[model samples]
Target: MRVEPAALEQAASKAGALENELRSVDVALHTTAAVRGLAGWETARRLEQVQSRLQDLVTGLANRLGGVSERLAATARNYRDSDEAVRRRFDDGR
Candidate 1:
């Protein structure tokens, strides 16, 4: 079976974009008025943790998607090469 890289790449891109957006939120939440008291500090800490975990997850997924793209490209090339070989062997009577 053949797998398309475009779908995987799009998903990876969306995940990366979400991670970036979360990172921006993290940065925005790191200030004085945002983390002033106990509740605010706890909220900021939890947000930091969430951002870190999501960043790692999205980065890993993107890396895996990249690998899948490369593998699928190689698979396509190998299939094309094999098809050409068969065609040459049969059509050319060689």
Candidate 2:
């Protein structure tokens, strides 16, 4: 079956329009994907920064706790030593 000249022209025009539409769709998809990728990278970077800050806070807290613990331990030792001395004096008087 032979297509008329007018029918052939119309078909070619439709195909061209469809081709242009497909190209536009592809460009839009690539642009959206790139934006998403950039956003993901930015999010990851921010998260890493937050994690670093949290680690620093944790380290500082741990150091402060260690210092406090050391001070308490020394106080306890001094109290024990003083108590033993008093006990010894009392026992000698008995």
Candidate 3:
């Protein structure tokens, strides 16, 4: 099974980008005060609860993306190391 380290690296880069984007969105959601307008109605309370849940979801997704990126990068490194080891052994045998 041939593993393309470059392809893995590219996927890792994309995952990292998505993680950053999600983090940014989470930050925007948390920092915006417009959602907490001056209203004590039950609907406003429900809206706050929904917003909180959405923020949590975004945070969780970002965390997962970060984990995926890390794993992908590690896999790519491992593949590259294995390839280098094989090449070195082949060269030594020549």
Q: Each model's RMSD to truth, in Å?
A: 5.6, 36.7, 2.3
Cα lDDT, all candidates: 0.60, 0.55, 0.86
Q: lDDT value for candidate 2?
A: 0.55
Model 1 lDDT per residue over 28-75, tens place: 344434444545567868766666676677566656656655665566
Could you arrange the candidates by TM-score from highest to lowest? Answer: 3, 1, 2
Find the candidate with the highest TM-score and give its number. Answer: 3
Query: Which lDDT tens digits does candidate 3 get at residues 1-94?
Result: 8899999999999999999998888543553464456376676676677788888899999999999999999999999999999999999999
Which residue ranges in model 2 land beyond 4 Å of their true spot?
Answer: 1-40, 92-94
- The candidate, 1 or 2, that scores higher on lDDT is 1
lDDT of 3 at 29: 57
TM-score of every model versus the real structure: 0.56, 0.49, 0.87
Q: State the local distance difference test value for candidate 1.
A: 0.60
lDDT of 2 by residue, 1-94 (tens): 4324444444545544544443344323334545456576876566556656665665565555555545555555566677789999999999
Backbone clashes counted, model 3:
0
Residue-level error in angstroms, candidate 2, position 28: 36
Give the least accurate 10-residue stretch of model 2, judged by summed lDDT. 22-31
